[model samples]
Target: MPRTALIVIDMLNTYTHEDAEALVPSVHEALPGIAALLKLARASESPVVYVNDNFGEWRSHHGEILRAALQGRHPDLVEPVAPDENALFVVKARHSIFFETPLAYLLGQLGAERLVLCGQVTEQCVLYSALDAHIRHFDVVVAADAVAHIDAQLAEAALRMMSRNMSAAICSADGITFDARRAD
Candidate 1:
């Protein structure tokens, strides 16, 4: 059986701020799908990984990113969460979560063969992660309804590119089903 995981990338207070948030309600529409996936992951005891951008928080640290997220300048945009202590997080300084983060090692450790990737900025971080994960040989499933972009037009283009460039299975969030876990 292949172990599966749900990865929610970005969706931070920095990217999603109130002004920008108001401008792009499509991002907000993604919330229910993400929440449902998170709930299913929790119920199934599957790992829920948060691959968030550090956004030049270099001078501080990952902890600082968390603090800034919970109570900071961009809380409305970022929408930081009190992540369950059990969940894994990779605070990324670069666009892709796999870079400079222990995501690959951790995913290998968890024996994750199938990954459900979701998050903000379809053209950048989310796109990079999906492609990179496919490169690393994980069966990638991208929830189309779970990704958002500040530019709807660009977001649509990104989706088309992802659907073509990567071996990512595109499915509506409501249609996802967690198959029984497979042994690695």
Candidate 2:
């Protein structure tokens, strides 16, 4: 069985952006599911990778970015999903996690043939990242309940596209299994 890695996209957010008001409620609803998946992945020793936006901070690294988020309006949301010391971190400047980022190479090094994507902007980052992952030949799974969004209708459409177009498995977080040794 191929190894599965959890790719958490842009969840380490400050929630101070223009769409923050529209996005916060969804994040609150999705927080528990994201937290659950993080716990499962950690316990099973599956790779936990955090692919976060740089927020135009050219000098900011993972720790700095995380610190800024913790200091943001919604530290509560940021805390539960914060990366542990063993977790891998990749900084991105765009919507897709793979866009001009080292994520593809990093996943290759970790031998992650399947990716479980969880995080914010269901209609944007998560959607774009799913397409990029599909093009890269990685089996994509989107934790439906674990992803937040700015627009509910667009998010629903994005999930449909992911399933019908990209062949991504659109299921709840509880439906995900992290153990590579177990039969699917």
Candidate 1 local lDDT, residue 35: 73
Report, for all candidates in order, the number of backbone clashes: 11, 0
Regions of candidate 2 where Cα sits further than 4 Å from its true position: 180-184
> What lDDT does model 1 reach?
0.74
Reference-based lDDT, residue 153, model 2: 98
Query: Which number leads on TM-score?
Result: 2
**TM-score of candidate 1 relative to the true fold:** 0.84
Candidate 2 lDDT over residue span 1-184, tens digit each: 5799999999989988999999999999999999999999999889999999988999999999999999999999999999999899999999999999999999998888999999999999999999999999999999999999999999999999999999999999999999744433
Q: Root-mean-square deviation of each candidate, in angstroms?
A: 3.0, 2.2
Error of 2 at 65 (Å): 0.4
Candidate 2 clashing pairs, residues 3+ apart or interchain: none
lDDT of 2 at 160: 100
